[model samples]
Each structure stands twice: as structure tokens, then as C-alpha cells.
Target: MNTVFVVGSLNIDQTIRVPSFPRAGETIRGSDATFSPGGKGANQAVAASRAGAAVRLVGRVGQDAHGAAILQVLAESNIDSSHVKLTDSASTGTAVIAVDDQGENQIILSPGANAALSFADVDAGLATLTPNDVLVLQLEIPRDIVRHAARAAKLCGAFVILNAAPSPLEIEGLFDDIDLLVVNEQEIQDLARLANASGDLAELTETLPSVLGPAVLCTAGAQGAVTFLGRRPVHISAPEVSVADTTAAGDTFVGYLAASLAADRELPAAMAIAGRAASIAVTRPGAVESIPWRHELPTLQDHDTQSAALFLSHP
Candidate 1:
């Protein structure tokens, strides 16, 4: 099996359940605080591993209790953390999250040690990837380092998969190195603005690959995801489920997609599996805690097989 290498951030998520999001300058009381191992990089790495992929995570954390706890969680998830760097200069990255009864969440991030992940770390991480391996990345770390890692992965003949989270104003040369670009609805709008293109989801989905890469996966919560493979857009419907917490839904999708691809599943099958896994994720709480294991997923035997076949046939 091809390995999934994640070059991204590791954060200790401090979450609280609230009646609703606090207004600006308003002090709102909430439920007791809870801590979890999260961050786009760690979440996706854990998700991929849980989805039955061999995942290696590369990033930085402080030499603090939070860092140790994060490492322990990764170990428990069966992710290789050997490349994870521990720094004394800064504390572990953190996200302050507030989730309401409606499962909507508001987050504030403090990069901390995550901002310190250097190109050297990226180089070491990319060294482990071989041709056909999946190299996953996010924007939580330094954009320059992300660019360098993407370029390096491309040079090594690895498949570069970038989840353009917290989308930036100018990606510059990074798009050239990405083989698969994953984005949510808001992220697609941000990218569209950056490219000076139409903000319409369908138009962006159709035209993004021409400017960005060969494929773009645009995820619209509840509405499912649309994958622009060349000029054709393949839509995958997300299963309907009551959402408990949506913190890790996107990460779960990205992770399962990478895992399915690494396992050599076709794009349609991979999307179906990923969508199902993400549907399961939103029904639970926390980041890594919410991601479903491979055994926990429903067997997509007859019905989903036909659906995937039909989608592929049409596209």
C-alpha cells in the first residue's frame, strides 16, 4: 500500500459547548472546557489511519504536556510520529473552539509552535514519500514552507494533495505543485476572489482546474461534494445525519479520500467512501475523537457500488 504522508500542524484543541456564539465584546458563559488532539494536519493523519491507511505525520509541537498528550493520541491512532519535531522555543499550537447546540462552531487559532515548522522539517518529511505516495498538506503552517514541501513532493513524483484551509490571498506558485486541491464552499469563494473569477460555485468548480490543477474537490456541507475532473463535474451526495459537532468533518473527508486513493480505489468510489465517513464524523463530537474507524463504517456493497458505477459512467 502506498503511504500517506501529512506535512501540517498539530494543535491542542480547547473546546467548550455554548448556547450560541458570543457576540463581539460579549462575555458568554459556556459548558466545561475539554481538550482534544486536533489541528488540520493531525486530524487528517488520524483520519487516514483510522480509515485504514498507513499514515506518517510531520509537524512541530512544544516540549510541553500538551505536546506529549498529542503525541500519545497519534500513537494510539497508529500514526507514525517519528518525524514530529518538539521545540522548546514555543508552546504547542492551540485552537479555542466554541460549539453551539446547533453543532455550529467558532474557532480561534494560536499558531504557536505550528508557525515554527520550517522548510528543513518539510524536506525531511518529503524524503519519506516515494512515487505514487499521497502527500497531504494544509495552510496552518507557513505558506512558504507549504509551497516548498509541495514542490519537493512533486519533484519526488509523489501525488500532492492540498487542503486549502484558511485560504490565503495569493497562493502564487503553489497551485502548480498540487495534484488534488480540496476546498470547502467558503474556501472556493476565497480562491475565486484570488483568481479574479466568478464566485458562483458551479462556475468555479468548472473553471478552477484550468487555473489550479487537474482536479478540484469542492465540498458543500449537507449538499455533498463536487469533484471537477477536467471539465466535467462529478457530484457525490453526503448521507443525511443529525450533526452533533462538525469540527473534523472536512478533515475526515480529506483523510478518507487520501486513504482510498492510496489504496488505488477509483475517484468515484473514493468520494463515496469519503462522503460516508464524513457523514459519520459529524454525528459525533471533537476532532480526532469524531473520526470513524474503517470497521465502524457501513459496508457499501450493492447500493453504493451501483451508484459509484453510474457516476463514473456518466463522468
Candidate 2:
């Protein structure tokens, strides 16, 4: 199986449940705090491994208990964390999240060690990719590093999946060789605008694929996702499930999508696997904790005869 190299952030997430999001400058009472291993990088790595992908996590953490706890979570998920660096330069990254009763979340992140990721680390990670592997990245770390890594991965002939979350203002050159671009509704708009693509979801979606030459997936919570699979649009509805916390839903989707692709499944089948896994994720709390195990997913017999690996590179 192709390996999924997850290059991104590692964070200790602190979740507080409340009746609703607090108004600015308002001190609101909430439920007891819950801490878990999170960060988009870590969450996606966990999600990929749980979905049966051989995974490698490349990122940094501080020399602290929070970091150790996160490393333990990676080990528990069977993710290879050998490339994960431990530094005293800063405390482990942390995210303070508030999940309202409606399963909506708002997050505040302190980059900490995540901000310290350097080109050297990117080089070390790049050295591990092969044409048959997958390189997964996010914007949690420096945008420059994300851009650098994507470029290097392309040269190495690896398939790249960029989840443009918490979308940045100028993506500039992040899509140079990206095979798949995943984004939520807000991210899709931000990306389209950055690329100067105009129109509604359908029009916006088409314009991106034409410009970047990548399959675009725009995830719409509860309403499902709109994907440009096989150079056309396909809307996959998310299975309706009772909501708990929607923290890791998108991460779960991205991870599963990569895993399925690495397994040589077609895009439509991969999206189905991803959408179902994400539905299960939203019915739980915490980020990594919210992602479901592969065994927990229903058998996708309909996709059992996937034609080919639609988005993978081979040496």
C-alpha cells in the first residue's frame, strides 16, 4: 500500500462546551474542559491510519507532557511518528475550542512549536516520499513550508493532497502540483477569490480545476460535499447523524479520501468512504477522538469494484 505522509501541525486541543458561542469580550460559563490530541496534521494522520492507510506523521512538538501525550496518541493510532521532532524552543501547540450545543465550533490557536517548523524538516520529510506515495499537507504551519513541500513532493512524483483550511489570503503557489484540493465552503470561496475565479459554487468549482489542474472537493457540512471528480461535478450527501462535536469532520474526510485513493479506489468511491467516516466523526467529541475506526465504517460493497486509482502517481 502507498504511504500517506502527513506533514502539518501537532496540537493539544482544549475543548469547552457551551450553550452557544460567547459574544466578544464576554466571559461565559461553560462545561468542564476536555483536552485531546488534535491539530489538523495530527487529526488527519490519525484519520488516515484508522482508515487503514500506512501513515507517517511529520511535524514538531515541544518537550512537554502535552507533546508526549500527542506522541502517545499517534502511537496508539499506529502512525509512525519517527519524523516528529521534540523541541524546547516553545511549548507544544495548543488550540482552545468552544463547541456550542449545536455542534458548531470556534477555535483559537497558539502556534507554539508548530510555528518553528523549518525547511530542514521539510527536506527530511520530502526525502521519504516516492512516486507511489501520498503527501498530505495543511496551512497550520508556515505557508512557505507548505509551498516548499508541495513543490518537492511533485518533483519526487508523489501525489499531493492540500487541504486549504483556515484559508490564507494569498495561496500564490500552493497548487503547483497538487493532485487533489480539499476545502470547506469558506475555504472554497477564499480559494476561488484568490485565484480570481468568479461565480456561484458550481461556477467557482469549475474555474479552480481549470486553473490549478486538480480535482476540487468543496465540503458543505450536513449538506454533503461538491466534488469535481473525473472533471465533472458530483454532489455527495453526508449521512444524517446526531451531532455531538464537528471538530474533526473535515479532517476525517480528507484522511479517508487519501486512504481510499492510496488503496487504488476511484474518486467517487473514495468520497463515499470519506463522507460516511466524517458523518460518524461529527457524532462524537474531541478531534482525534471523534474520528471513527475503519471497522466502525459500513462496508462499501458498492465500491468494491473500483476501476482504478484515479488520482495516484506511479513510478
Candidate 3:
């Protein structure tokens, strides 16, 4: 199978459970805080590795305990963390998250070393990518670096997939090199508006093939996802599951999707695995811990979309 390179962030997720979101200037009692390995880039890398892809993570972390923990998790998964550097320029990135009884969450990010990742530190590693490999990215890192990596990866003929989570103010510039664009409900609207594209979700999905030059997948929470993989748009349903935390559900989906595509699976098949993986993620807790493994997915071997309903509905 081809390799998957994840150029993203490393962070310590500090989460607390609250009865509900606090109002402006309001103080409320919350459950004891729990710390875990997180960061969109790191989470996606772990998910890809767990899904059976050989993953190499390229990012930065502070020379601190949080960084150590992040590295430990990568090693546990047998992911190549050599590209991840320990920088003293800033502390490790951190996220303060609060989840409610409904599994909805709000997060506040403090980008430290994550903001310090420079292309120079990862240039040599990125240069090793082959045309058959895949490069995955997110918005947690610098936009310029994300663009730079995308351009380089595209030029090498490698597949480039971007998960536009935590959508930025402008996304038109980043589309020049992306092979696949994955976004959620909010991100799709933000990106469409920023790109000066006037259309609803269906309209945008229909138009994105011409805009991004490849495929687009827009996830709709538990309802499933809408995909336009160079074909007409298809709405795929996610299996029913209990949601305990929505923290890294999107990241999990992106990771599995990238792995499937890199393995040369059909677009519909790739979309199916991603949705199924994300569905399983919602039923668990934690970020990295919540993602399902390849073995956990009973239908992982089904590469045709014809039987996707059978594979997804049963789980």
C-alpha cells in the first residue's frame, strides 16, 4: 500500500464535561478535566495508521511533557514520527474543550509549537513522497505551509486531500493543488462564500468538481455525507450509533478516506469506509482513542459501492 504523509499539529486536549454550554460571562460547574493526545494532524495520522496505512507525521511540538505524550502515542501506533520536531520556540499546542450531555462540544485553541512548524523542518521528509503516495493536511498549521506542501505534493503527482476543518477566512488560494476537498456543513458554506461561489450544498457539490478539479465530500454529522467524486453527487447514510463525543469524528473520517483513496479504492468505496469509521467514532470517547481500526470495520474489504448499504447499515 502507498504511504500517507500527515502534515499537521500536535496538541494536548484538555476536556471537561458540562451540563451545557456556559453563557457569556457565566461560570458553571463542570466535570473533572481530562487530558489526552490531540491536534487535527496528529489525530488524523493515528486514524490512518490504525486503519492500516503506513503513516508519517510531519509537524512540531514543544520540548515539554505534552510533546512527549504525543510522540509516545505515535510510536505506539508504529507511525513514523521522525518528521515531528521538538522546538523550543513555543510551548506545545493545546485545546480547551467542553462537551455537553448531547456530545456537542466547543473548543478553544492555543497554538504554540503548532504555529511554529516551518516547511524547512519538513522539506526533506516531504521530498520523499512518491507519485503513488498520499499527503493529507488540515487548517491547524500555517496556511502558507499547507499551500506549499500541497503544491509540492501535487507536482510530484501524489494525491492531496485536505480536510477543511476549523475553516479559515479564505480558501480559494488553497484549491490550486488539492485533489480532494473534504469539509463539514459549516466549512462548506464558509469556503463557498469565500470562493465567491453562490450556491447551496447540493449546488456547490455539483459545481465543486469544476472548481477544485477533482472530488469533494461534505459531511452532515450523523446524517451521513454528500460526495461528488467526479460523478454526480451521492448522499451516503451513516449507521446509527450513540454519540459520546464528537471531538475527532471528522478527523477520523478524513484519515480513513485518505487511506482508502491512496490504496486506489473507488470513490464510493472510499466514502463508505470514511462514513463507517466516523460513525463508529461517535460511539466512543476521546479523540485518538475513538477511531476504529481496519480490523474493526467488517466491510473494509468491500471495495464496491453497490453493497455499501449492507456494510454500513449493519454496523
Q: Estimate each model's TM-score.
A: 0.94, 0.93, 0.93
Instruction: Output the lDDT of residue 84, model 2.
Output: 92
Number of clashing residue pairs, candidate 3: 0
Residue runs of model 1 more than 4 Å from their true location after superposition: 301-315
For each candidate in the order shown, give its overall lDDT on alpha carbons: 0.88, 0.86, 0.85
Q: Supply the TM-score for candidate 3.
A: 0.93
Model 3: residue 159 alpha-carbon error in angstroms: 0.4
- Greater-lDDT candidate between 2 and 3: 2
Cα lDDT tens digits, model 2, 106-211, are: 9999999999998898888668688998889998999988888888899989889999877887865668778889988788888877887876665566568887
lDDT of 1 by residue, 1-315 (tens): 799999999999999999999888999999999999999999999999999999999999999999999999999999999999999999999999999999989889999999989888878877878897999999999999888988898898988899999788796787889988899989999998888788466667778888776478888887777776555567777677999999989999999999999998988788889988999999999998999999999877534423222333432
Could you tell me how far off, in angstroms, the CA of residue 97 lies in candidate 1 after the best superposition?
A: 0.6
Candidate 3 lDDT, 267-299, residue by residue in tens: 787778888888888888888888888889766
